[model samples]
Target: MSQQAALLHRSTHAIPKTAVGGQGCYIFLEDGQKFLDSTGGAAVCCLGHGNKNVQQAMIAQINQLSYCHTAFFGTQASEDLARFLVDSTGGKMTKVFVISSGSEAIEAALKLSRQYFLELPTPQPQRTRFIGRTPSFHGVTLGALAAGGHILRREAFRPLLTKKTSHVSACFAYRGKKDGESDADYVARLAAELDAEFQLVGPDTVCAFIAEPVVGAALGCVPAVPGYFRAMKAVCERYGALFILDEVMSGMGRCGTLHAWEQEDVVPDIQTIGKGLGGGYAPIAAVLINERVVKVLDAGTGVFRHGQTYQGHPVSCAAALAVQKTIRDENLLENVRRMGEYLEAQLRAKLASHPHVGDIRGKGLFWGIEFVKDKSTKEPFDAKLGIASLIQDTALKPEYSISLYAGTGTVEGVRGDHVILAPPYIVTQEEIDIIVNTTVRVVTDVFNSIH
Candidate 1:
């Protein structure tokens, strides 16, 4: 085995079989097992696998000019990609900063938010803290890790993590809502918690409030209760803190819209996107800044002060441009909405009333199933049970052939379990049925065996 195999086998427990090939909506193992990739490989493959256009785009770019440093020359592909991103936002987003991964996009957003405040006079020198929500996931990068709230993921690195970040309760209505609270009241309470956090830290002393429009990884695709984002955005505005939305997993076409915030009706000052942005064709991510945020930099600093040699590389940009155009030209977002409704119906009809299923929630093709010890009580499994961990494994059985993205500590940072299933936008009705049937069977079997 190569060092890659050894490292994954030893360091990452419960690693899956080798994915020798992937096409359309499935990944093939070296042993000839074809796993239905309902999770779209972490919701990355919006264009499905083995997209010919994206491949050709990459090949042609590499053949022409593979590796030109951004320091010396700018690429047409990067410029075109920027135009596409900005235009996708209806000109609301004026500028696009390219980066390598979701984490890098987040790192850039964090830096940009801080720099936004720096452009302000005196800029409230004490405004160094960042506000995030419990059970939120930003990224693994240092700045992103500091902003994230998963207790287990942030434990060992606490010393190295930034100390100024604080967390508020997430608007997870399934678990966090009061017994008899209305949606309006629940959103109010969460907003109050955020307001209190800002006050506690002195609003002017905070840099930005970061959150995923739809909670990914940590909370299993939980969208905020109605009015949650509006309230949250109001609070941030009141405090003079920029609202940063991490739509890395939920944005692009995953949520049936170009921007996840579009559904919420409130745009962020700085938005981070990745995963489906390039449809997993190449490593690419970006930070989309609104005109207001960019104006501060242009007027005050005259520069963003952030750049990487590969920041706007030609090949990555070309791959992403092709992916975005393919999505738009193919009219896949409509399919996302239609198929999303079907998937939701199947999940609800098949699994919602199951004894251990706590919640089934998502938007567009991105969806999640939360498991619990008792659905009636909304109590979570003990972390040691590893409900999420085992589901991802059992679903990949030789006869079954499925891949599920498992997440734990969804309730807080160490007590709940859920598995996310975001299939490719190109998925057919037959494939959707296969995924639903396989997942429901595996999930039901897991709980029955455990109970």
Candidate 2:
């Protein structure tokens, strides 16, 4: 049978069908099934599949220089990509450290944050701990995992993870906002909680406050309230701590802006971005250091004490450069905004009235639909129900032929159900309609069967 399965799959007993081909938001299975990629493969395929420009760029780079270590020589592809990213930020971010994945980028950010404090004239090595939000996701590596607040993902590794990082409540309105609390009051309350945590941890001991501008995965596409980011940044500033934003799943025009923090009127000292950076064309992520931090480092050590073998892979950089250029050349950000409004309207019109649908919230092209057992009570379905997982499985059925991003533990990282929809920026009205119809049908069928 040609070795039915030798690979260790995510689930020990279940092996997914092999995908042989994909193009422009659709994946082809070996069994002649075509599935619509509504979640854009975890929101990474921003430019969709089979992009000729990105492919050509990668090929060209390979023909010239495939790989070069940062410790030795810098390639043209890497330099150009860095310059493009810095210019995109209007020089707000002065330097870039290209890495292999989002986790690595976050790791770099954390280390750089610590190093920045040390590089200052009045060094405070006591600033060693980090503060992140509960029900947030940073990355999967130990340091990054420790910084994240995902209960389920961190459960097994809790004993091994560092305890230096602490967490506070996220600025999630659907569940976090009380019945009578106004937006200003909610922001104040959250800010108070953060300030209290800093005091509890000893303000000088905290290094930075890290969070996703738009919470993804752990709390599924939840955005902050109007004045939330400003308040959080203020708290960080008061403690003399760096403000780090993890835009891995929300940056690179995924949220209708080049940077998710742009809409909030808050600038981060250090930022990490991935997913859409290379748009699934190659593995690439980066850490963007603001001028303030770069200046301190340049005056002191003049070197970041970190190194990776493939720190700035030329071919990967070329692929990402090409992908980013395409997003700009095609004016996809405008399409993201226009199509985002249309998609949200369609979703609300179709599913907002469903008895189980509790919340439909997001910005730009990123949206999350959270399901509940009782709408009036805002009570989430039991974890044992695996409601979100069921919907995702049903979405991929041959009859439906759709892919969804499912997340669990939305409420305090223990009990909640939600699915995210982040289609490619190039998605059209027809594709949006198909996605909406399929999602509505899938959610309805899953709940109907359970009921």
Candidate 3:
């Protein structure tokens, strides 16, 4: 039997290489091969592997207090982390709920939004519905899954998902925008569609309108057109519904901003952040509650009716606190903005002429390259071919030795392929060249082999 025989991996038949250690932007396998971590493992490793600051912080917290049940007592680590997050928002967000992962943060946001309605001076018991954008991913947990509109991820759990959630068009300009349509017109049309959905579902019954400022996995790193989010927030405000932003994959300086919504010119009532929050140093995510919702709850319940066994794990909080501090102190966001421009320029310069390269879109260090069978038509390759998977598999080979985050169903929830490139914020320009060159080679190899 193999070493992994006792383990249950995501794929039953395939066992992945064993990673012995990681340093900076590279991972070392047991077999002595090294692979450059290009996508940060689903965009999680902002500070990259074996970061000394986060490691020491985790070790220090472990020595002081490893865990603390939130119900019994709160630890200094959690309090400090929460304070840092709130202060990061310039006091726009007043409260923070720390959790274990992005999915849990989203679940907490969902329940909190629901409870916010009940805690209002005049309870909106009927406000139980949630509105999300199609081709968007919030998380994999049931509550987050229900609020998400990724068809493939939800198909198996259809019977288990909540029926109270509805979806509208995602702010994906590459696929959704019509020919010759101005950005303003596209934003207006999407806003109208959201308004119609609210009217269709009875606006009074809605609890929140949740969306990612930059759509990650489901649609790759697709950002909204200017004024799109402002318009959507307006609709939610007009209907008295809470606005939530799921920044799980694109927040925490991933987009050259502390919060992705900072670029969108809107402050969400509740925002979910993870991935980059802890920078893969510890399992942690958080929900930031705005003053508007905090006041309502403070006036009424003075408590959020939710609890998790590991809601604020001290070690996790300590590591995350260190990660945030490192980002701020090292001026990494500035690097993200500077390096992001270079990465985009290099990608476009090299791959723009590739017939199979459909679109290259993103902000900061988060980017995605969608593949197509017909460049002029923007027709995605047949899903069965698994273009994204092929690129990912080929990129991991010893010859190439680089890791890329790949996604299918980019066109919708069933028929497109794209790979994301989210290098660590600490990445240098030389490393960016390696990533770009390796990516071009891997992509070219895959397509050439296919033909």
- Counting clashing residue pairs in each candidate, in order, gives 1, 0, 0
Question: Which residue pairs in candidate 1 collide?
Answer: 127-205
lDDT of 2 by residue, 1-451 (tens): 1345778778877888889999998889999999888899999999888899999999999999898778889899999999999999999998999999999999999999999989999899998999999999999999999999999999999999999999999999999999999999999999999999999999999999999999999888999999999999999998899999999999999999999989999999999999999998899999999999999999998999998998889999999999999999999999999999999999999999999999999988999999999999999999999999999999999999988799988887999999999999999999999999999999999999998
Angstrom error at residue 64, model 2: 0.3
lDDT score, residue 189, model 2? 99
**Which lDDT tens digits does candidate 1 get at residues 328-413?**
99999999999999999999999988988889999999999998887778888888989998999898788678878999888668
Residue 264: error of model 2 in Å?
A: 0.4
Candidate 1, which segments miss by more than 4 Å at Cα? Answer: 2-16
In order, candidate lDDTs are: 0.90, 0.94, 0.94
lDDT of 1: 0.90
In model 2, the runs with Cα more than 4 Å from the true position are 1-4
- Using alpha carbons, what is the TM-score of model 2? 0.99
Q: Across residues 190-253, which tens digit of lDDT does each residue of candidate 3 receive?
A: 9999999999999899999999998999988999999999999999999999999999999999
| Span of ten consecutive residues with least summed lDDT in model 1 | 1-10
Taking all chains together, each candidate's TM-score versus the true structure is: 0.97, 0.99, 0.99
Model 3, residue 94: distance off in Å is: 0.5
